[model samples]
Target: MVESILGYSPVLRHCFRNVSGKQFPRFQVIKAQAMELAKEPGLCKEKERYRDSLVGLKPGSWPPKNRADNPSLYNPLARQERMGCGWLGAIFEWEGVLKEDHPDLEKQSWLALAEEEGRSPPPGFVVKRIACMKNEQAISEVLCWSRDSSQLKRMALRKEDIHQALQGGVYRFRDGSREFVNVLTRHKIPVALVSTRPRKNLEEAIGAIGIEGVFSVVVTGDDVYRGKPDPEMFVYAAQLLQFIPERCIVFGNSNLTIEAAHDAKMKCVAVASKHPVYELTAADLVVRRLDELSVVDLKNLADIELTEFGSTPELEMDVEEEEDDRRPPSSAAIGDGFW
Candidate 1:
């Protein structure tokens, strides 16, 4: 009410006075009601709904197991704890774990692509950063190349062509890769091959390497949109093998593979192919060669030792009070700097 108008009417002034203040009982009650309603889950600002959207299957996919409709492969044993190759799977990486890896060829491929596309050549660290990424993913995400699907496809193909022409069509297994694969086969363990290579290229390489029938399942870059350090490849490989990630072991050659495998809820054995064994300490087990591992080793790795609290707790102390360097490598350290 205006002061001049309120002076003329005392009753009207008294009623309208202090109406904008929160001293009223009804105003306090309304404030309390709003505070209570804000506590509702939908109104909560902090809590996130990541579990249902991330766990098990993708958003709209069906349940992984349909035991009622589909017959199960391995019958459940009556033991308290199960142990055997009957249900375990071995997932191997192609370029490094099975066949020897040549980091030079990889770097060279990128350099050749850069030269052909008139882009600046990626430095050594940049090359290392994208070592585990698929060609198109590296082109778009890391190298800042054209995001157009057609251009990415063309450049990725051209890079592969350069790599193939430089490396030739030869496929040689690393020192003990064949022996380790045979051991798994003899034990009747299903083997899976996962790689960033395209399906056709990987199939041709397997054929050339004389191990066309070895892999029970092969997951290539074509099967997934992204590559390491995303867990999609390993997770999808586990699914294709009809085995839980816990029952599968991933054998890879770098910290990226170890990170991806762990994210997929699988144990990983890092092979010291292009990387040194000491540098791969993040893996469940690091071996100079695949043959260095035995059936018992794999079994122990597959059966993760969990604590009463569900997860294995980190130790309060480091190895003999030494610096803790066993942490996994991070790809994010490369930032968004262009090559």
Candidate 2:
């Protein structure tokens, strides 16, 4: 019995690790719930109106009820003030009214709503609060974007042209890429790039590398409802690749990108393209260069293994994997003369 438990110690460690983290399961669950509520078909107009009202209004003059019915009497400037600087009480009360009046929102997931907003769900909701324990580490991650490859930088192509070029022989192969793409192709696991740059830049960069065919998907900010740190972009990438967020591995150097991956429930590898390894402490795994990592280095992140009684394996993998993958490759090994 002792050996059995000891053998499964890593799974226990994984749970404890998440529990010890500041955001843990609560924030994740809530955000998901809120998105569910937002997708209600009947509540579309009400949600849109609520969002509009909050978008440009100031702090002190928010509407207490639906402004559409009594537009003539509504104080637009005062409303703006309220939105800009309203106390939490006022904001909560008004938002409550907005939700209450929206018939579509009547059946919406309140627990999800509260969680996305990082607040407690109101009374009458079914969600049990994921309690915040003391001394939890803050959940933060990076959202990095690589600089445009040299060819794209020189051409200054338009976004549409970039996308068009990507499908054909538009991009040409050159330096710096042999290391990143060659190794991944050798392993048979598809490698994709997620970027916040314009489509044109991405297309040119891919073409320059001459390995555009290697990727199963390339997700950019234009394809998402929101940019990095919001989770939409990463989620879209996972969908396009026919991969679950948990099964995906992200390589990035930005705080926003890292946070976005974390929010999507994906494992992230931080690459030190522009920043030093020490600055990338928030990443789950930090790599100084891309060459040091291979397919086997990411085994722990392949899938979520469940224990018999219900537990996930601890992420006992060493930080060395992260360190190795982050380093730029040697020139002769991968053909990346740019490095």
lDDT of 1 by residue, 144-236 (tens): 988999999999888888888877998799999999999999987889998888888888888888987888999998889999999999999
Candidate 1, superposed: residue stretches over 4 Å from native? 1-86, 304-339
Q: Which candidate is the best by lDDT?
A: 1
Candidate 2: tens digits of C-alpha lDDT, residues 89-151: 100000111111121232233333335435454453221111110001011111111133443
TM-score of 2: 0.40
TM-score of 1: 0.68
How far out, in Å, is residue 159 in model 1? 0.8
The weakest ten consecutive residues by lDDT in model 2 span: 87-96
The lDDT for every candidate, in the order shown, is 0.76, 0.45
